[model samples]
Target: MKITVKELRLILTVDNLDELIHFYRDTVGLETSKEWHEETGNGIILDAGRASLELIDSKHAARIDQIEVGERVSGPVRLALRVTERIPEATETLIEWGATSVAPPTTAPWSDVARVQAPDGMQITLFATSTLEDK
Candidate 1:
């Protein structure tokens, strides 16, 4: 039988949850769908617009790393976010918000992309396309 999936949520247990929340929600502009600051724990769910799971083999992953970052710097999981435009500006903004720049914006076969390492060490790829048709 085929099981249907509803939504995908990438849950990250971070040490600096507030900092990450600011980086993702405030700086990156993801809408906060829900948040909790009870005695159990503090957590916030930011709406990432849309989500999809991308699987890549080691060879292809390395190739992408080389093209974007000029080195193999990402781990098994990487976050690729599609932006409306201005990848360079967004990348710089992310860097100023405490994310480390893995690479500046570069033109790729698919879109203009930039890589940044989040404060929690998650490698994020920011790609810009004019519209969904362009994507």
Candidate 2:
């Protein structure tokens, strides 16, 4: 048998659902893709640009951590976001909205990245890939 997938989305089960919704929509700037409440529970899906499933093992995740933050994240899950050159300014604004800094902006071999903890306690890496070669 063969299977095909069309779209992918990240579903976060958070204690503060409404707060997370506001954070991702207003703070992180992701538009609301879909939201609904069934008899079971409530769900909110935000449009994280160019969604794709990234399945990585611990070793690979550690490598990514080393490259991005010069260290390893304590958990198995970490969120990665690609932003523009305005990362510093954007990160400052995000911090104002309740995100705590895990690491300051660092220029890595692959991209410039910053590690942060979201209001919901998720580890996030804000990154920018555009280099001098891209200009």
Clash number for each model: 0, 0
Give the distance in Å from residue 114's predicted Cα in candidate 2 to where it truly belongs: 0.5
**Each candidate's TM vs. the true structure?**
0.92, 0.84
* Cα misplacement distance, residue 2 of candidate 1 (Å): 1.1
Where in model 1 is the C-alpha error above 4 Å?
130-135
Mind giving the per-residue lDDT tens digits that candidate 1 earns over 20-124? 988999988999999999998899989987677888999999999999999998999899998765998889899999999989899988789999999999999
Task: Report lDDT (CA) for all predictions.
Answer: 0.89, 0.79
User: Can you give the lDDT of residue 101 in candidate 1?
Assistant: 91
Off by over 4 Å in 2: 37-39, 130-135
